[model samples]
Target: MTAHTATTLRSAGSTGISLPEAIRRADLGDAVALLASAKKYTVARLSGGRLSVPGKGSFADGAGVAGTSTERALPLSTSGPDAVFEARIFNKDAELRWLHEGDGLGTAVVLSESPDICRPLGEFLDPLYAVEQIDNRYLLWGRPLRSHDSGASTGPLSTGPLSTGPLWVRLAEARIGLLDVPVSRAPRENECVFLRTVEYVTTEPEHGNAYVAEERLVELFLAPPEQSKAAGSPQPDRLPEATR
Candidate 1:
């Protein structure tokens, strides 16, 4: 029999709290079971902007950073009667490593920053899985999409090799632009791939200088088409966020 270990899901706050305990106290095992039934996990914020899990841990300092507010600590929020959680996945190293959610299975949510998280989680979950790192170099075949303002046009931002450094300069000269979104290159067709949508927040009052608090709502999706589907045609998955 495959041994099933109870994965600990903790809360975010200055005082560390146990999410699983709270869930038990609130009698929310049914809700948690419902979430797990999807074969997917979700991260969301609860009262006091504290991170709540179906099982262990409570809302407390997620990253152990001093003076960070609860709002800044957890970015994902719950919705409706079921309190479905939501968050935006951005590109960040630390947040990706610590806060993002993933199943022990060979699947995980790809947050915004550092596409490396996909590989890292993949390796952590399935040692036998081969991870191939791909530079963010692709075309934005449609309009830009923003999490806050869906109507606002951020323009087609380039990703991959076209948005980086010396390569960026050459790509810019060649008509390519900076990359806005980064995507993974593995988990071919029919495979379930996890994609995280993290929303970053900061205790700092200034919008420009605040730091990223936490990542929430690690999402899952089907892997895109293979090279055969890329015969001079843009893959739908490769389209701009708006189009997607």
Candidate 2:
């Protein structure tokens, strides 16, 4: 009875030899499904259909291919959560190493032609330091030059006043011309603002293994406390300050 059953099974297997080819041929007709997985897998067009499977799944088993995909071609997702997490840990470790073993901060001398440009710097180091000029540069003194019920810091930057705040002052001194607005919320006129920002840009998954790197540029803007302002109430004769 066992021999008879084995013979029957062998016959069935022999007749089903064309089954794998038939399945592969049918799969090739649906090109969309194959292209959909292209981001996560190394998809290549075969003679009849496309090959779409996981890194571990064998093309030979599914598409009746001869060998597995190459190592460089298989891992399409090189920068996943795991890679990013590892990169963060690596950056932290590097910072800690620098803090422990790197040379500490050192003082440097920056000679300026005029003291007007460098005067507000003292206020950053010591908020109590008094600033003398406050006409257009009220924001540099860390006080609102003008305000409204809306509570917006400054009017729309384009039409807002030009105070020649710290950045503009420095840029003017250095003769640097910026044709475009550098900051997203660039301070208008007299505001002295400090901002720290990070931006990450990634390519589409169809591009295959992602390329990533951390690049940073630190630019600091410092200002002062209220300068040339005195405590006083407006008399009936005097007009109130303009709040645009």
Candidate 3:
């Protein structure tokens, strides 16, 4: 299939659009559709070759599965800073599981992976105020609340209290590299594997009644546990100004 670039809508006004709706209108479909189409290196298929485009029938596998009642344990490495941390993106709860198992640190870090799953997770979370839904399975990472009296400027607009929110391009440019790793064919229950080089876009809701915003070309990177920290740190706030 030919690749298509999705358009973003900023609000719920006449021409404004919600992030989810914009994604559908952009013809990119859901998270799976966006990921499958954006990354040429990843292989995706449908049961009958119907072409799983978003908003057209049931496209992605396990599209509406409920969240898993039980949390799965992730494998960690014991090799200190130099180890491999593997994660599975598919879960009934739509969560991304990060299992770090190598040397001495063997722990499972499970947050709302869906925040990281969508195209503009960073943009959404940088704000100071926004509403989120837990039943949606996908994590809605929103920014903190902003006061109308506090004059903070962002992006192209400058207002005393009404900021323009975060910049989408900066979020998209964050240098998260992608890797394709070999996944296990047959694994036990709650066990999943995957090849790397995964990519997807994110749509974050704006504060108040403004349009839902989105970020494109969000890349996923896999690095050594130590390298991942160094790369992800530095900014250590919301989304970095720029990713390598």
Best by lDDT: 1
Model 3 lDDT tens row, 188-244: 212111112212233444633532232222222212233334433322233321111
For 81-152, candidate 1 gives per-residue lDDT tens digits of 333222222222312222213322111232323333344322323111111221122233222222112232
Error of 2 at 217 (Å): 2.7
Residue pairs with colliding backbones in model 2 are 163-189
What are the clash counts of all predictions, listed in order?
A: 39, 1, 35
Candidate 2: regions farther than 4 A off: 1-98, 102-161, 167-207, 218-244
**Whole-model lDDT values for every prediction:** 0.26, 0.21, 0.23
Can you write out model 2's per-residue Cα lDDT over 1-244, one digit (the tens) per residue? 0001100000000112121232232232322111112122112222233323323432222221112232112122223321111000001001000011112111211112223322322221211111111112111112222222223423322334333411111111112221111111224444433221111223345855422222111222322222212312122223211100
- Judge candidate 3 against the unseen true structure and give its global Cα lDDT, from 0 to 1: 0.23
Ten residues in sequence with the least summed lDDT for candidate 2: 1-10
